[model samples]
Target: MTRVAVVGCGSIGTRHIGNLLSLGVSDIIALDPDSGRRDCIHQQFGVKTCEDEEMVWNYRPDVVLITTPPKLHLELAISAARHGCHFFVEKPLSDRVEGQDELVEICQSRSLITMVGCNMRFHFGPSNVKRLVSEGVIGRPISASLDAGQYMPDWHPDQDYRKRYSAQSRLGGGVILDGIHELDYARWLFGEVAEIFCHGGKLSRLEIDVEDSANILMIFKTGISAMVHIDYIQRFYSRSCKVIGEEGTISWDIHGALKFFTAKTGKWEVVEPPAKYTINDMYVEEMRHFLSCVEQDEATISGVEDASKVTRMALAARKSMLNREKVLL
Candidate 1:
């Protein structure tokens, strides 16, 4: 029986715990500092809940899911690594790059199986886009565009949007860090970025201190360039990507289809996700993959070391926005 401990017990953490139970891995524990959150998970999922961090370590879990805010990620990860526990952290990895190298080093020295939650990579549309690019459906990719935005107030209707981490700077909230899925998948499809120029800031009337919008241009080491736009001001949720290649173009719409147009075919090709596919499916699949990798002591799709690069890119974009200059990686 593999024992699992999920720290945070918030929205994403609760989702993971439910997925774990559905996957039939039931030896689970939920950790949170909030008594209400701990009790809620205990009643909802029937998992053992702990209010103290030490109690989680005492449980001797083989794996710990660090779903806390970005600011708290590195510290919790380090503590988990010291306890000889493998961990899966949520996206962006951290708000800054200061302590990331240390966390990577600790995980490496322990030979622990680690994964970062960039679940967008597991989504059908993005996965197929990566595959089509790799298969050369769009020959010699030249330039690309990626955009994602959603109104912050509409995110969690049950709670106050102002209190959510996505709206707070100190909690690592902002479009750049919050929407890092775009940056991660951009690198996943294209190559490493050599330099980045970003322009945009908290241009909205949203009651937040962080930048609510960002438009970034990245020049990849492959000489390819991409334009990325992210914002929290859109009234409706929107996400899409278009990659133009020398011979063709591939595009993806979150609510639509995966499409491509090639000079060879002189027409458009479309691929749709399976009938029962839902956004939650990606989360479930990612957790399933992580558990399998942990059992086999194998590598994960998005490990800490590789994810650190994405965090670096995000930080660089912020740097560019603040300094009003292109940042070299």
Candidate 2:
């Protein structure tokens, strides 16, 4: 049995706990400062709960899942890695690039397996898009357009949107960082982003301190230009991307089918996800993948290196937005 300790028992953390239990993981421990959340986890999942993060060393967990805010990810992950524990950290890596290089170095030097919580890479739509692009079905991707938006209030109907981490800049919340799935999966399909130009602000009257919207332009190392739009004002959730290639085009949207157009066929083709596919399915698959990677001593879907690069790109976008200029990475 693998001893796993999960830090932060928030909404996402609880979801991971549920999936870990369903996967038959025994000897699970949860660490969160919030007693209410700890109580909920104990009652809902019957997992051991602790308020102290240092308890991980005593528990001797083989893996630690960091689901805390971006501000705390680096500190917790570094501590866990120092104890020779594998890690699965949530995305955006951290609010800034501070200590990221050293953290990556520590993980690599210790031969630790790490997986970032960018579940979008496991989504059926993006998975299929990667396959099609790799197969040359769309030829070489030349450009892309990606968009993701949802009303912040709708995100957590039970809580005040203004107080959530997504609405606070200090907590590493913003459309750019919170909705970073677009940037991440874009890189997964295209290549590394070399330059970025962005413009956005509290365009909407959202009662939050952070920017409510942003439009970013990225030039990948492959010279593929991509545009990304994210916001917190959409009444209905929306997430989709379109990739344009020399010979065809491929696009996908959440809860929708993949659409492709080829110059060879001159017709549109659609690829629908399996009828049973759901958003929760991605997290389950991600946990299974991470556990397997840990057991096999293999790299993860989004390892430390990829997480650091993605964080760099995100920070650059923030800088571009503030300076109102193009940032070259």
Candidate 3:
């Protein structure tokens, strides 16, 4: 069995551990500074728990899942790569503006496998969008828009939402970074983002320092324009995207399924293959792919380079928000 270490015991970290266990990975270790969190995991899974990050390195795990926080992701990932271990870091790459370039360089120099938590790409709904774009099913996507949002307090009723990483900017918690799922999907559907114009702030239902609403406009190299609306004040979680082309448009809803429209048909039709998924499904697939990469000695499914592009988009949006001017990225 491939040895793995989870460097955090927060909500997502626990989810990753559970998914890894479900995959029959017994050689697992958990490291969390919070004694209570570590104790709970030790009692739940009987996995070794340590209060030190160095113990994780000393454990000599073949893979490390850095789910600590965005600010610590680069440092942890670099350390893991230096130890000749593969790494899996969660979404939005890093919170800080610096270190991303160096992190990619280190991973490249060591030939280390790295996976980012852009799980939307692996989901059936968005995977079909990628397939359709590749096959020219939409006659070259020209434009697209996405809407993703949810109420913050509703997210964790049992725990204080303010204490989570998604609550503070220093922790890489905000509408843009935390709400970046749709941004990655749009990139997967179209091309690399050329420039971004955005306006966002903490002007919504939640009483937090971080933003609860964001509106972003992206320009792609292929002359494609896209808009994204993200908020953390919705009572119901909604994740949906619509792609428009010269011929027709295809829309996919994570809550529902796929809906198609054609000019000639003049009617909206639901066209989809068998698809069923959940948040945990992405976690399972992410861990499974990380396992396969380690076993086969192959490259990671999603590397630092891919995740950096998405980070650049988020960073540009943040810049736009602060400077009160459009930022090119």
Give me the candidate number with maximum lDDT.
1
Order the candidates by lDDT, highest first — what do you get? 1, 2, 3
Candidate 2: 10-residue stretch with minimal lDDT: 51-60
Task: Give all TM-scores, in the order shown.
Answer: 0.99, 0.98, 0.95
The C-alpha lDDT values of all candidates are 0.93, 0.90, 0.84
Candidate 3, superposed: residue stretches over 4 Å from native: 264-267, 272-276
lDDT of each residue in 1-329, candidate 3, tens digit only: 68999998888889888888899988999999999999999998889999998899889998899889777888888888889888899887887658889888988888888888888777777777777777776677888889988888888899888887788877878889988888887887787888899898988756677888899999988899999999988889888888898878889887776877777688887856454546667668767887888788788756898888888888889889888888777
Q: Per-residue CA lDDT of candidate 2, range 1-329, in tens? A: 78999999889999999999999896899999999999999999889999997676799999999998877888988898899999999987887888999889999999999988889888898889899999999898899999999999999899988888889988888888888888998999888888999999888888888888999999988899999999999999998989999999998988579999999999999998988888999999999999999999999989988988888888899899999999999
How many clashes in candidate 1? 0
Model 2, stretches more than 4 Å misplaced?
none
Better of 2 and 3 by TM-score: 2
Tens digit of per-residue lDDT, candidate 1, span 70-174: 889888888999899988999878898898899899999999999999899999988999999999988999999999999999988899999998889989998
Candidates by TM-score, descending order: 1, 2, 3
lDDT of 3: 0.84
